[model samples]
Target chain A: MSEASVMTDELRKQIGVAGEPLVVEMEKGMLRKFVDAIGDPNPLWSDEEHAKKTKYGGITFPPGILAAIMMVGNRPPIEIPLPRGLDGGGEWEFFEPIRPGDTLTIECKIGDLVERQISMGKAIFIYHDTVWKNQKGQVVATSRTYGLKY
Target chain B: MAKQLYYEDVEVGIDIPTLVKHPTTQQLVKWAGASGDYYQIHYDKDFAIATGLDGIIVHGRLKIAFLVQMLTDWIGDEGKVKKLACQHRGMDLPAVDMKCKGKVTNKYVKDGEHCVECEIWTENPEGRKTAPGTATLVLPSRGK
Candidate 1:
């Protein structure tokens, strides 16, 4: 078997087992930072009064902002020992606006391992999926990201 | 309220305003702080080059974020982003210019909700598509 296959098999074994649901509380500051960093000037994401006049009732985090936090949460804790990795790719589907004060519970799963060889070294790619739901049990978003490790 | 771009206002061939971003190492670091993507490829030039890339590359997710923002801002609040998908086509290096632009490609109305479909892409200084994708958004209308 290829080195990537071996690593993937080990990773599959690690699995983190069953994914534990995580509750992410939406905050305006985090949302604003993302908007500013991305250079988005949409008033709906930054303006409350204007947003309230819309169908969404009030201000909401843009879909990309919703995905950004989930990507942030996918990292290894600083204290943990881990190998370096590359970001291979990602995909996301937005089902609803992520409103401030809304707590989102995510259903996460580690996907299959994909292997690719590069001049640098042998790289293993893994896909991860996270589904976000609101306190009302309504599905809000689904985000998938790919990470590469040597 | 600003006037919403209705299905009547958009045509399949019209171009939308383009977005430009000056990606620097610091910006990547800042994005890493917010994104929690500590992958070496984003910040380590030597490591990235080792991976066969000329230099450190921007995160694919970050590019996707910019594309989504471009569309939603154009469609306005009453508009809803229905679907978005992108395929990475090139690499964006730090201290380089990346331009994002889009064009309306399709339009339709379903159950009283008007929708406009757009084609979006990012270009490097060499004028190559870095990332290309499509988005479907629901645009508000006047009435029945």
Candidate 2:
């Protein structure tokens, strides 16, 4: 059997660490549902009149709305089933506003892999990074996700 | 419905508007559909309990959306959120109200962008910070 440390390094080199691309469409219903489900009553995302008056000139996505879109999917790049995924938090950088009907293609890779001994036992902290680009090939946003798996 | 925050007007130590949100299992269900993170830990109470959680917990990303709202609402339409980062330190269960808050930490101008940095977090009903992080923004200057 492989030691935990060795397993961690090997997983980093093999999976999401291998750097792969996943594509997903940014749908309007999904975007609206995300804003509504979060209990956000922002007119900019819902009310057409309010959105039309804003700089976007139409409904726009909230900055963190991508969390719901990026996560939840069984896409490759970071496809390791380590079971317990503890929340390590995430970082987001926005370049352009995501408008309605835009398709986003993501390129993801694993960043840092460190082994830690916690109260629960031994775990590996995985840093996942993904860049989001619009169909026009413009970089729209990027995120670095932090997760812990044991 | 909101005034734009001008770069010259905001000072360090200013507070972003606070947002208090109460999440429910139904909301989590909706989130599950939207995010695709249908991990039972967020919606299945029985499975969560069997796994040792108090109950089905709110998705940490959902809490992040609430915090993002606070920051964006405070800046109004003219400002831009350049970066946001947070780490989930505590679990937040549904049915409890969480407070999303932020305070300015720094202000500066770089590359012609009037930038501001603030510390942001969400506090569970028990008054413990469940998520803590930082955000950077660029607001339009009155003259620029």
Q: Highest DockQ: which candidate?
A: 2
lDDT per residue as tens, model 2, A50-98: 8898788988889887666453233344444466768788899999998
B25-119: candidate 1 lDDT, tens digit per residue: 88788787776567788899898889777889887778878888767767766778887777766678878888888998988887776878888
TM-score of chain B of 2: 0.96
How displaced is residue B144 in candidate 1, in Å?
A: 3.9
CAPRI rating of model 2: medium
Tens digits of per-residue lDDT for model 1, A62-126: 88765564533433321112356555556667787788898888777775565567665666666
* Local distance difference test, candidate 1: 0.73
Window of ten residues with lowest summed lDDT in model 1 chain B: B1-10
Docking quality level of the chain pair in candidate 1: medium
Query: With candidate 1 superimposed using the best TM-score fit, by how many Å does residue B62's alpha carbon deviate from the native?
Result: 1.8
